[model samples]
Target: MIHDVAIVGAGMAGASLAAAIGPRARVLLLEAEDMPGRHATGRSAAFWSETYGGPAVQPLTTASGPALRDGGYLTPLGSLHVGRAEDDARIERLLADFAGSGVELSRVDPAAHIPGLRPEWVRGVREPSCAYIDVAALHADYLAAAKAAGAEIRTDAAVTGAGRRDGVWHLETRAGLFSARLLVDAAGAWADEVAKLAGVAPIGITPYRRTMVQLRTDPPAPEGLPHVVDIAGNFYFKPEAGGRLWLTPHDESPSAACDIAPEEWDVAVAIDRLEKVVDWRVEAVERRWAGLRSFAPDRAPVYGFDPKTPGFFWCAGQGGFGIQTAPAASAMAAALLLGEGGVPEGLDAERYGAGRFPAMR
Candidate 1:
């Protein structure tokens, strides 16, 4: 049986898109792993911060707030951007750029907010509207909803080959063969590969490694501590349960698509950077893991159908904002998939279209 749409990946992007499109189409959400979200979606330190994706992505993030809250996926948490006294220019630029962006940002004394802030780190911006995303819950809900909507979800069904004949896509996977009218490339870091399998030009959606380490600290990380981030992208940290802190060096080393593991050097760099920001002592490193954050050349997400490929859709390059922007992004993607009627009310669709990529064009 030929499905209306078959989405590759089954991570946040594919799962959410399935939930949105299943009501209108016969959908298939496919995953290579035995379970969905074992890649980037499962390993994200997700927070709904308007400042996280810069100006281009702020609109999508902002528009998604209501839906996320309604779904019980967002938990209130302030996002603090701190920097040294010498980094005052960074703070000024952030304030000026987002002055009217509706992010609820404000200047504040860094020391007052963080217990062990360094003396020289006096400048800061706080996004009071930011909140932590329950990624696991969100992913599960999207998958479940898609299933409820009559979308077929298949795990361990890795796509080995794809082709089109007589206006239909024939996909060969480890599990079995499936046919569809449209193929959506939502395969996180492997999206480009999926396109290649379908004889579509690759969009240069490169993946980068992001490392996160959980550390046991002295004085115990405050449960109420805001999500602390360095404006210059050196480091970010927030409290985890059991007095541990989830820390990252904000590292973005380029890598190929695969199961990623944290580099020892990157882990050490995170600890070092965190030490400079906070006076807390790292008693021990409890755990360290890494995930791939894929991006297009422009560092913005790519949505919409491929300009040249007849039945292929581009839904990759979400970077780190996939979870935060999932609600609106999926809605926009669904509208694009179903023609032009339900375009999420306020989102500008042209910015993320596949036509923007010279290679795809």
Candidate 2:
């Protein structure tokens, strides 16, 4: 049977888009794993900060804020970007770049907020709107809503090959063959491979590994401590429950598209960086993990259809901001796919359009 649209990944990107499409179209979500969201979505150190994804992505993040807040998936966890005196220029540039972008940023003394902060880390910029996200709950809700809205989901359906004939896509998956009028590639790290299998030009969507570690610290991470990030983009950490701290070195190691694991070198680097930023003693390395973040050549999300391939749509390359921007991105992608709704207001549709990529054009 032919589905109206078949998305090749049931992670946040695919699930949210499926939910947004609702019953307006017959949608099918194909998962490569035993269940959905086994990769990036499930492993995200989830946070929703308007400035987290840079200026190009700020609009979508801002637009998605309301939906997440209304759904009770967000809790206050302000972000503090701190740095040494020499990094003040980065702070000013950040404020200048996003001056009119609706992301709130203000100067603050680093020591006033992050206890035991090194004195050399003098300048700081605070983004009070940043908050933690309930990623698991959000992903699960999208999947459930999509299912309830009449969209079908099949797990262990890895697309081994894809071909288009007579204006219809025929996908051969591990589970079985499926036919769809329109094929959507929300395959996360495997997006480019899926495009290639469909005889479409690959968009250079590269996956990068990011490392995270939870530590038991001495003098314990203080209660109500803001998420502290370095202005140089080297590290970020925040207080977790039981007086522990969740930290990452902001490592973006280029990697293959597969199940990933944290490297000891990266973990050591995180600890080294954390030591320089604060006086906290590392009592134990409680937990460590890694996840993949895929990006297009330009880093902004890719939406819209292939310029040269009919019935083929591109909805991958969301990178690390996929969760925070899911609501807006999915809504916009759904509107583009089904032509059933208007693009979210103030969204720079062209920036996110597939046509923007020279390869797609």
Candidate 3:
């Protein structure tokens, strides 16, 4: 098969990139699993908030707002941050830092709003702009848009090797061999390994494990409930589709690149934190799971061609913000690979490009 661009991994990053370049170029999207988003993408907390990541990632989140709203991928779920008395300063800093970023937040005593929440254990900051994302629908929409624009997608087509030959890149996958003018690495946790196969220098991408547990409760949760995070981010809980609540300890332990599973210790930690904040009693744990969040040395995404490897491009190191930044990140990746003058209106490539990590080069 011959294509203009061959993309590895079919998560948000790869799928969105294929969608962006679909009209202008022939794209081949390859996924290792039987279905796309089988790993971290499928296990996301699925919330969109500009204040989640720091200033560096705020631009991408801001740029994606329009698309998220217009595409009907967001539901107004709001968000709250609760801290103990000692965390008042951190709460203040969070509010002050994100004020200019369009995050509307206010401080309040826990007793004023959350009667069940222990007053001695909590102080609260609320942001009305936070919302829940329809992750499955959003991913499907991107795939549909890419297919509609004439891009080819193949599942279980894991790329085993990639190399330049006769001024073109040859990608060997489980299904078959593909030739392309350019190759893109969007393999998430395995990004560095993919780069090694393509003869590109490793970029120090590390995958961290995060676990979440679902608990069932009586009385059901109120509709339109906001997502809540502890001031220390030790734990968070959000209402799910049914009467259950999805909770996490916000744990980010260093992990090997693989299909991660939740640890008993981590689950215990989450339960302990949840018990300290709210008065709700957990009847039972419905389920538990874990996923990997990959990060580069600087904790920023890398989007550009490899300096030493011709016809090889990078679009990795997204961490947990992959879904939120997909739109702009994909556009930026495609534009840079095509040698376009600059990134799209809202995104600046200088901060996100591979050049920022000279040590990687």
Off by over 4 Å in 1: none
- Per TM-score, what order, best first? 2, 1, 3
Q: What is the C-alpha lDDT profile of model 1 across 1-361, one tens digit per residue?
A: 9999999999999999999988889999889999999999999987788888788888889889999999888888898999887888898888887878777888899888889887888888888888889999999999999999999999999999999999899999998999999999999999999899999999899999999999999878987789999988899998877878999999999999999999999999999998888899999999999999999999999999999989899999999999999999999999998895688867999999999977777
How far out, in Å, is residue 1 in model 3?
A: 4.1
Q: Identify the candidate with maximal TM-score.
A: 2
Ordered from best to worst lDDT, the candidate numbers read: 2, 1, 3
Residue range with the least summed lDDT across 10 consecutive positions in model 1: 337-346
**Candidate 1 or 2, higher TM-score?**
2
- Residue-level lDDT for 191 in candidate 2: 95
For model 1 the local lDDT of residue 304 reads 91
Candidate 3 lands at a TM-score of 0.95
Q: Measure candidate 2: CA RMSD.
A: 0.8
In angstroms, the error of model 1 at 237 is 0.5
Model 2's number of clashes is: 0
How accurate locally is residue 290 in candidate 3, as Cα lDDT from 0 to 100? 98
